[model samples]
Target chain A: AQSVAQPEDQVNVAEGNPLTVKCTYSVSGNPYLFWYVQYPNRGLQFLLKYITGDNLVKGSYGFEAEFNKSQTSFHLKKPSALVSDSALYFCAVRDGKDIFGKGTRLHILP
Target chain B: GAGVSQTPSNKVTEKGKYVELRCDPISGHTALYWYRQSLGQGPEFLIYFQGTGAADDSGLPNDRFFAVRPEGSVSTLKIQRTERGDSAVYLCASSPGVGPLYGYTFGSGTRLTVV
Candidate 1:
């Protein structure tokens, strides 16, 4: 079965600092990975996706993710984090089916 | 264009009652999906529709949970004999096609509370 793993339950970073949220997946075929952000009381918002071609994919809100095929990883990153950037981040992978990670709560301390 | 929209932003019902949640997908979107999200977990896929047909209903927990897209544009999820465990935020999303790269656009979601 295809599955996604988000190692951290929460990540704390200071405002204006770089942020990183790790994600890894296990799938049988070529993986299609995605990153989504959810604010309080709202549904998941699409941030970015890695389907084919480029390993480094840029997305909304200055977010970017690197898809590493060998390590089965697609970690989300931002150059400088803002306080408003804090939210729940989810990494998902598409096998034959779409499977989501447990989710990582991000806190940007000002 | 407007994003996906769901009706009844919040619904509270007694256990054993029935409830229906509605979803209107983006204009011209061919694929729609339904998911359930708990307090702290990621959304769990419940079903998927391609046009007017249900292409994947495997994620549905049981027969008590059912969904229909009669016109291939709007969809409804009906839950029978709702239990306390069924309380969660129900989300609806739409995509242009089956490709995962097309990433889904989600609605604000309906918060269902079973008393």
Candidate 2:
């Protein structure tokens, strides 16, 4: 079985400051990781994915994630946070079966 | 191009009533998925379709939940004898069968409220 964990229920960051949302996963074989963002009353939008190759994967809206194999983690990062970037974030793992974390509510303080 | 689209942005029905949610995947996307999202949780996969056939339906909660993609494009998720616990936002997503490399494009979803 595959599973994902997002330890933090909410993350607060100041606008213009960098932000990170932590995610970890457990899978039997090679992991396929993904990050998604959901705005209020909207469906989730794809951010980025880590299937293989590079560890650092850049995605839409200036978002990026680093896949750490040893740590079994893929944390989302933004060089500079924006108020518009505040939303619900989810970390998912696709190992034949796709499993998602409970999600992290991000609040970018203006 | 238009992303995945779902119908009836909001649906409120009484318990035990039957409801059908629809999804129109991207024009060329061959893979479609249905997921349910509760108030504060991440979307949970309900079913996945590769063309006209269901590739995986393990995530479906029970036999009362059924889905069909007869034409391999538009799909419908039907729920019978709905319960209050079934209330949630049903989301639809699609991906071009380009392997797992490509991510899914999601629909705005239909918010189902069981009264």
Candidate 3:
């Protein structure tokens, strides 16, 4: 079985400050990691993914995630946080199929 | 369609009633997937279809839940008996192939409410 976990139920960050949303996973073999954001009453939107090559992968909306092999972690990061970035963040792992974490609510306070 | 489209943005039904949710994937997408999202939770995979054949249906909860994609262009999820526990947002996504790297595009989702 494969699973992903977002340890924090919520993450609070001040506007213009850097933000980090933690994620970890347990899966067999090499894993494909993904980060998605969801707004109220909307579907998940792709943020970034780690397939191969570089440990750090850049994605849409000025977001990026680092794939740490030893730590089995893929944490989403943004150089500067924006109030509009507040939403639910999900970390998912894909081995044979996709497995998603419970989700972490990101709050950017101005 | 330019993006994945799901019909009936919101549906309210009484318990024990049968409900059908439809999904129209982006044109030319060969793979389609169905998932259920409950309050405060992530989307749970229900089924996956490759073309006209179902490649994976193991995620489905039980026999009461079924899905079909005859032409592989559009898919419908059918529930035999609706329950309050079944109330949640059902999401539909389409990918060009079977890989997370491709990043499947998702629809707004169908909000199902069983009273």
Worst 10 residues of 2 chain B by lDDT: B96-105
What is the C-alpha lDDT profile of model 1 across A4-83, one tens digit per residue?
99999999999999999999999888788999999887778999999999999999999999999989899999999999
Q: Lowest summed-lDDT stretch of 10 residues in model 2 chain A?
A: A91-100
The models' CA-based lDDT, in order, is 0.92, 0.92, 0.91
Q: After the best TM-score superposition of candidate 1, give how far the Cα of residue A3 lies from its true spot, in angstroms.
A: 1.1
Which predicted model would earn the best lDDT?
1
lDDT of 3 by residue, B59-102 (tens): 99988899999997999999988999899999999988887657
In TM-score terms, candidate 1 sits at 0.97
Where model 1 places Cα greater than 4 Å from the true spot, the runs are none
Per-residue error (Å), model 2, residue A13? 0.3
lDDT of 1: 0.92
In the range B2-21, model 1's lDDT, one tens digit per residue, is: 99999999999999999999
Best by TM-score: 3
